[model samples]
Target chain A: LAKTTQPISMDSYEGQEVNITCSHNNIATNDYITWYQQFPSQGPRFIIQGYKTKVTNEVASLFIPADRKSSTLSLPRVSLSDTAVYYCLVGVPFSSGSARQLTFGSGTQLTVLP
Target chain B: DAGVTQSPTHLIKTRGQQVTLRCSPKSGHDTVSWYQQALGQGPQFIFQYYEEEERQRGNFPDRFSGHQFPNYSSELNVNALLLGDSALYLCASSGGTSGSSEQYFGPGTRLTVT
Candidate 1:
């Protein structure tokens, strides 16, 4: 499992773009970078995932540099409702008996202020 | 379309007691994973079950055990629980063993040990 590091908190205004960066210096070749958004009293929701380079979805985008040591989650045009904690995980897909649990770190709390 | 569901949205237990938490996976998911989240902290993996078998487990002690049913519903059991066991227990489900697959989470079971 690759250890991940992310900011403890971030503040963003409504309609502004927010970027949260996560560092996983020990990322493996087979590991994938994934991001999840969690609201209070709700489960973490999958936002975006990528192996390398950039991947975009309707909700967010993921950018991974060539080193694979770090990745960024970009949320565009944020709203107050988008205020939540975001988690970044780095792990290889389950293979054989490997469980590769989603080891969550203290996530980046993005406060979307008005 | 019903997402993962967990029972007893909140539970209170005493030290040295035992508790059981339940989870029903999404409509088509076959794997169920459990996690524990403390206040101001990220979730910690407990274990994962598939096909009625324990496929993978985390660093948690044996006191934290789980079982999966043929219907893909699961239970997390804690024996001789301690005060430290108090936390939000989360249940997540995915399609299979693939680590890259997205996991859907349920409203966690907030366990308060008194």
Candidate 2:
């Protein structure tokens, strides 16, 4: 399993764009970068996932470089409801014979100010 | 379709006691994983169950065990609880046998050990 390091906290204003970056210096080739957002008292929600280059979705965008050592999660037009802890995980996806466990770091706390 | 459902949204236990938390996977999901999340920290994987068997486990002690049923529902059992064991327990489910599938998390069960 690869360990991830991300910012402890970040601040953004409403309607502003937020980009949280994660560094996994020892990421494996079979590992994929996935991001999750967790609000207080709720489970972590999947944001975006990518192996390399970029992947976009309705909620967020994931950017990975050629080296695959780092990835970024981009959230557009932040709002108060978007305030949460964002986790960056690197792991093999779950499969029939492969029971890969998702390792979550302390995560970056993003607070959206009014 | 229901994403994931957990029973007893909250629980309170005493030291040396036993407790069981239940979870029902999302429709069509066959894999269920458990996690422990402490306050101000990210979730840590406990174990994953598929095919009614334990497939993978984290660094947790043997006191932490789990079981999966034929319907894909699961139960997490903890015996001889400790104060440090008090945290939010999360259940996630994923479908298919492909590596592209992502796990969906439930609301989580808050457990307090005194």
Candidate 3:
């Protein structure tokens, strides 16, 4: 399994782009990098995922370099509503199991200021 | 379509008691994973169920167990709960057993052990 490390916290002003990077130096070949956002008392929501290069959704963009040792999640023009903890996870699959688990780090808490 | 849903939005139990929480996965998903999230920390994996069997489990104790129904709904049971068990329990659902799948999480059930 691969462990991820991210910043503890960040502050961003409204209408500014926020790019959070996560490091996973030991990610497996078949593992995928996923990003999730969570607000207080709610479950983490999927933001974007990528294997290599870049993948973008309506909400966020995920960038994974060829090395796959790290990834970045980009949120354009973040607003107050975007204030939440962003988790970077390396999805792991058991060798002989049907279920897979994602390990969530402490995550980078992004606070969007006024 | 309705997303993942969890029951008993909040629960309170004593140290020597037991508790059960329910989760309904998103439609078309077959795998259910359980996680425990403490205050100000990331969610920790408990276990995962697929095809009505325990596929893989995390480092959680034997006191924590789970079951997945044919309909893809799941139940998490904890025995001899302690105050440390007080936290947000999350359920995540993903489609297929292979790699490269994104998970959807439920709103979570808050369990407060006294």
TM-scores of the candidates in the order shown = 0.95, 0.97, 0.94
Residue B85 of model 1, lDDT score? 95
Question: Mind giving the per-residue lDDT tens digits that candidate 3 earns over A29-77?
Answer: 9888888899999999988878899999899888899999999999999
Instruction: Give the per-residue lDDT of model 2 (tens digit) for B75-101.
Output: 999999999999999999987543446
DockQ for model 1 equals 0.58
lDDT of 1 by residue, B1-114 (tens): 688899999999999999999999988778889999988888999998877888888889999888989898999999998999999999998875444378889999999889
Please compute DockQ, using alpha carbons, for every candidate against the native two-chain complex: 0.58, 0.71, 0.56
* Lowest-sum lDDT 10-residue window in model 2 chain A: A92-101
Best by lDDT: 2
Candidate closer to the true structure by DockQ (higher is better), 2 or 3: 2
- Model 1 residue B70 CA deviation (Å) reads 0.9
**Model 2, residue B46: what's the lDDT?**
98
lDDT of each: 0.89, 0.92, 0.89
TM-score of chain B of 2: 0.95
Model 2 steric clash pairs: none
Off by over 4 Å in 2: B97-100
lDDT of 3 by residue, B1-114 (tens): 898999999998989899999999888778889999999999999998888888888998999998888798999999999899999999988875434377889999999988
Give candidate 2's error at residue A40 in angstroms: 0.7
